[model samples]
Target chain A: MRISDKYRYLGIKLTPQRLAILSYLDGNRSHPSAEDIYRSVRKEFPTMSVSTVYNTLDVLKEKGDVQELTIDPRKKRYGPVNTPHNHLMCNKCRHIVDINKEFKFTLPSSMTEGFELTGNHVEFFGFCSNCRKKQ
Target chain B: MRISDKYRYLGIKLTPQRLAILSYLDGNRSHPSAEDIYRSVRKEFPTMSVSTVYNTLDVLKEKGDVQELTIDPRKKRYGPVNTPHNHLMCNKCRHIVDINKEFKFTLPSSMTEGFELTGNHVEFFGFCSNCRKKQ
Candidate 1:
């Protein structure tokens, strides 16, 4: 779906900044952080504030339109995909890619500590091809 | 192993502050962040700095004595467990627990995107019993 149509389908407000953000994220696989998104969009919207980017991301995350990844220790990365899957990140370049496959593993009921498992995310870390060549 | 003996095993300098931090983290399952550690340590030291906590954590992380968790979006949390395992977090209270079991998963070669898989961590998020009771 197009960016505008996606927000419309989700009943999100169609602001110009949001439109620009959605356009940037529509098929973005980099799993960009809020700063990355802000920097990317600011090229076109120079007056865009980082707080606005964070707020928009918060709304999108609350709406389940995007997945916020804690794969990187330095910052949170956002992905537009909603499918249940794991993430693979390059330890060298910090490049992130979606695994797009279900890695099902049952946490023994004994270890659950009386908590129900709603969902799980796996982050696999290694050197990407480019980073490997650099080393 | 005791905190002092653990640092001795890793050949880390045993400063009074590091000892204080390590003693605090010994068998700690709360997964406190750098700020959390700083705040906790400051109660006794009164003048302990956040940077000292972070530097100590960095050394501990490098020595493979602690694991840094990105489960919290606001900050990075640390665990003293060195075992290979996953983490479970309470989505409501932000409480984190170590899932001390092997959750072995294999990624098909097709999904690797030319990256070698070094390690993977699973973060399971849900409400804790206390939070559930509150609802």
Candidate 2:
């Protein structure tokens, strides 16, 4: 079977397990963790170990096919590279949501200290309605 | 001598070591790590330990006098709460700089999933001119 175009650029051997992981990450905005992905993919590959999922993720991360997020502070989450975006998080519950729109910003050269510009990620912190009611 | 007004709101005992730390962090935009603080504070109080710096940082962080940053991935950095600001980083060298200006953004209510907005931090990634030259 041919590898899905989602992971075509990785240029690595596409094991059945790696293909499953890549399929899971395609268009995934929930930013699930390694364990989260393993738990879901394990349904199909019952014998698959979490390490397999981690190794696949590590390879994808190194290959720039995936982006890692630690917006939750205590846990790692993964999102698809299909769109460059930022994140919004609930300070109380630590729930994270994606913000697909890019903000236009430029730092004065004096402030950047001669760094050539590339890209930016904005993390917005807030209280979810449920958490806000708890206060 | 009286403690500087910078730490007056923390309301903790003004030990000489804690004072030195607060003084070190006061108006400090370098986003130094615990070891960085320890290294600099050691110059004056050779008896001071790294843990002392860590504990003091914990208290200040708990009290909201400092904000922790993990931009470097391998290490943690810190900045004072004196002013709300964002950061610009060198993707090549991982050098970080402060951008004191705030970027205004509004997420559609539908996008937030009912989060009450509070604050945002933008992390700009780039290659410092020196690193670009080296490449």
Candidate 3:
């Protein structure tokens, strides 16, 4: 979908700052942090603040248009893909890539006996190709 | 298991400090942070540092005797139970409780398409009883 349409679909007020963010995130595969997004967006809007970047990201996340990843411990990463998917994280260089494969595993009845299951996320951690080359 | 026996079984050398930590985590379910552990242990050992608490927790985690949780954003929480389980986090009060239930859900093949799935975790977010009462 077009960036303009995404903003309209999310019912978000289309400000210049927000449009820049949406444009940057559209089809962006590299999971970027709020700081990373702020620095990149500031290239055009030199006066953009980190807080604004975070606020915009939070708004986008709440709208279910973007996903926040906790794969990294230092800072939260944001992904443009809103679909259910898994992540591949390189432990050496902290690089994150999307795995487009489907997983099939039934949780044994012994694992979820009482509480209601809301959601599930699968994460694969290992050395990526670049990091493997370094070693 | 007894604290002394746990250390011996894990092949970990037991020091007075280490024993204190083990005793504290033997069956702990509160999901305490490093700071919380350090503070609690400090009542007995006045000089216990935060770094020691973190180091001990890291070693314990590596040995598979404790599990570290990313449910909290500010700090990592550790659980004493090594069994597979899910967590219930109260968004309002930040309280974490364990749900000793088994979950049964086959991940649709569309969810894990290209990558090897090594592990999975289920996290449920909601207001706990106390937090619900507050609202």
Q: Please write out the lDDT profile of model 2 over residues A1-135, one tens digit for every residue.
A: 334553454346768887788889988877788889999999999999989987888666544456666465556677665445588776545577888787776777778788777667788866777777643
TM-score of each model, in listed order: 0.66, 0.64, 0.64
lDDT of 1 by residue, A18-89 (tens): 768877887787778899999999999999999999888766554445567777777788876444547887
Compute DockQ for each candidate against the true complex.
0.40, 0.40, 0.17
What is the TM-score of chain A, computed separately for every candidate?
A: 0.62, 0.68, 0.64
Residue A133 in model 2: shift from native, Å? 14
Name the candidate, 2 or 3, with the larger DockQ value.
2
For TM-score, candidate 1 versus 2, the one ahead is: 1
Clashing pairs in 1: none
User: What is the CAPRI rating of model 3's predicted complex?
Assistant: incorrect
Error of 2 at B61 (Å): 2.2
TM-score of chain A of 3: 0.64
Candidate 3 residue A100 Cα shift, in angstroms, is 4.2
lDDT of each: 0.73, 0.71, 0.62
lDDT of 2 by residue, B1-135 (tens): 234453554345768887788788888877788899999999999999988887887665544455666465556677675445587766445576778787778888888888877777788766677766642
